[model samples]
Target: MDTGVAIFPTHDAIAPADVARLAEQRGHESLFFPEHTHIPASRATPWPGGRPLPRRYAHTFDLFVAVTAAVTATTRLRVGSGVCLVIQRDPIITAKEVASVDVLSGGRFEFGVGAGWNREEMANHGTDPRVRMAIMRERVEAMKAIWTSEEASYAGSHVSFDRIWSWPKPAQRPHPPVLVGGDGPGVLDRVLAFGDAWIPNHAPAGILERAKELRARADRAVGLIVMGVPADPRVLEAYAAAGFARAVHWLPSAQRGPVERAFDAFEAAVAEFTGE
Candidate 1:
């Protein structure tokens, strides 16, 4: 089981470069950053967590930019978007950005995508809330074509394009891993369709068994990436037993001090678990 770190790259958090370097030095497998292009002022969409959305959601850094910085600063630590909102962006532009990052990072990018929960925010991007999942699926398929082909093109219900040229195809063969994020029933179907992994955030207890059954039913070899986990050895063992390929723990804050302390604690915990 690989251990990784995920952070909300906010104005007050640790710089991406520093975190990347530290995580790499500490033997962490990956550094993931979450994305929120822009939070709408309208409070029509209730927070999925059942509370007011945090201010950090509005002040978050662009995930591609943050991940690019981290990749440049570290050689081995994988860089990922913990969960990028695929429904809100133009698939063509996103495809280019993803391919560029993969090339620049020496193929160390993981594309974790999701149909986000912000209805108003999706509305701002002209995306229909009712069809967000369908749109997201089409966008991901379109991006995959762009990443793998020199004269790539796509035609789908939500995405259609003529042959267009894009450079710097991903360093990783067939492009970086596409990890779908969600716990919905349809989400598993989508993952089996195209994603290389499934990442569910703070899943319910007994989720592992359920996910295993789902994978078995689909006959997919994709991994299960569990995010937002606490830094506890016992929890790690449980996740491992549950067949998690990777587990990501959150940094308490993005500030240097808190991030450093979190990394220290994580390293110790990982070491204790691995007997290193």
Candidate 2:
């Protein structure tokens, strides 16, 4: 299995270009950054970890900008949004961003997407939390049309546009790989429907069983990328044995020296686990 890294690039953290170069030099396969447009200061939604939200969530750099910096700094390291909240973005604009990165990066981009959990946050974007799944699906479908067709159009309850021309068609023929994020019930269904990969947080239990089940399907093929993985050799071995294609180690937002030290540690763990 291949190893990658994920970070929430913040104003105070190591610059993304440096992170990308270091990750490439250390022999990592990919770099992923996640998005949070803005976190509401007060919300009824409790953080899943039962603690205050991390500072990084409130301070993250824009996903596209971070990914662009990383990809431009390194030629071979794949860059992605660990989970771009599709329900909260304008699909047409996002389609252009994805294609631009893919084209400029020589086809090395992965599109990881999710229906986010913050109700008030989504409300701020004019997205209803209750229908986020449907909206996310429609948006992704619409974006796919925009990417693959010369004069593409989509008509959906949430997103619709007339025939439109979009340029810089992605270097990857059918656009960058869409890795659907989340292991909630029916998430695999979404992956099979329109996504090129299945990405789930490596925690919250039962994911191992789900991964095994997904891998058992012989008729369909999908990439599997597990996010927020622990840098444990045993866990890495288990993931590879369970048929995971990639595992992303979490990189906490921090100043350059500390963060680079953490990368070195993770790199050593990866090398040991992969016998490289």
Candidate 3:
């Protein structure tokens, strides 16, 4: 199993380039950052974690910008958004950004996307929470078309556009791996439908088994990428045995000391568990 780190690149945290350089120096395989274009103050949608939304969400840096910084700072470490909110973005623009970053990063970009949780926040972007999944699906499809075609266009229920040419296609042939993030049934189906991987938070027991069964039926080698993983060797081993391809440790905050400690612990645990 490969190890990665997930961070919220906020203004208060360590710079993205520095974090990426540190992760590469520590021999971590990848660095993932979460995204929030902007946070809504309405608080109409309760925090998923059952407390006030954290300040990091409101001050997070743009995902593509952060990834670009990471790519510029490191040679081998893969860079990605832990979960880009595709439901709120324009697919054409997003496709161009993804391709640009992938090319710049030498194909070391993982496109992890999600239909976000905040209803009022989605509304702020002119996205309907009711049809978020549908919109997200259409957006992803549109982006894929753009990445793979010389003159691409999409005309879906939620996304429609004329044929237009885009340049500097993704460095990775076809496109970067599209990893869908969520835990619901619909989200799993979306993963099977378009995503190359399923990125879920640490799931309940038997979830991995169920996911394997679903993957078998779909005849897809769709990988399982777990986020917010505990810093335990046993847990890492268990997840690997359960078929997770990647496990990413989430930092409590972006402070340098805390982040360094988390990476140190992760490196030791990985060495102990995998003899790498």
Candidate 4:
């Protein structure tokens, strides 16, 4: 499987430009930075990973700005938002940002998006957590329209607009690839409906089987991108054998020393797995 890296990109972490430069220099294929506009202190919603939430979640830089810095620092390394919280964002502006980055990076932008989990966070953005999936779908559909048409418009329950002109259409033809992120019930339906690719956090059991089933049931060929991959050759080999298109390893938010150490280890694992 092709190997990429994902980072939280906090203020205290290594600069995104440096991280991207190092990733490309080490032969990594891509760099993804995740987003969280702001983490509410209400503590109404528990952390997705359970227990104390990481400090980086609250301190992460704007995903677009971080990704722009990263992509600007490297020519070959693809940079993207690991998963933008589309349910909380305006689709029109998001489409413009996606197209801008795609154009600026020579079509090296991948749009990974999710509905998100934090109920309070969604509420803060004026989105209802219960209906977030529907909202996310509408927003994604709207963005697609903006990216592909001369005078774009969308009519949906959550998102609607009249014919509006949007320029700088994406460099990647119709649009950048939309990689939907999640592994919850009904997620496969979402992936088949709008996503060009599926990104599921790597799970220990039944994931490869699930991937196979998804491929079997899909109407057209779909891409599988496994995220949160550990630096393990055997696991990566299993992913490649299961026909996964790519695997993204997490780079912890830290200073350059720890970040590079992790990169070295991950690169070694990748080289071993690929027999390079």
Model number with the top TM-score: 4
Tell me how many clashing residue pairs each candidate has: 4, 0, 0, 0
Better of 2 and 4 by lDDT: 4
Which lDDT tens digits does candidate 1 get at residues 1-276? 998998888877778888889888888899899988898887888887887777888888789889989999999999999899999999889988998999898899999999888898899899999999889989999988988887988989889999999877888989899999988768878888878998988655756876777678676588888998776777788788878989898886557887888888877777777778
- Write the residue-wise lDDT of candidate 4 on 1-276 in tens digits: 678999999999999999999999988888898889999998789887988988889999999999889888999998887899999999999999999999999999999999888898999999999899999999999999999999998999999999999888999988999999988888889999999999988899978888888898899989999998999999999999999988999999999999999998888888899888
Better of 1 and 2 by lDDT: 2
lDDT-superior candidate, 3 or 4: 4
* TM-score of every model versus the real structure: 0.95, 0.97, 0.96, 0.98
Q: Name the 10 consecutive residues with the lowest summed lDDT in model 1.
A: 202-211
Q: Residue-wise lDDT of candidate 2 within 37-95, one digit each (tens)?
A: 99998868887768988888889989999999999999899999989999999999999
Q: Quantify all predictions' global Cα lDDT against the true fold.
A: 0.86, 0.89, 0.88, 0.92
Clashing pairs in 1: 13-254, 13-255, 14-254, 14-255
User: TM-score: which is higher, 3 or 4?
Assistant: 4
Candidate 4: what lDDT? 0.92
For model 3, which pairs clash? none
**lDDT value for model 3:** 0.88
Residue 231 miss distance in model 3 (angstroms): 0.4
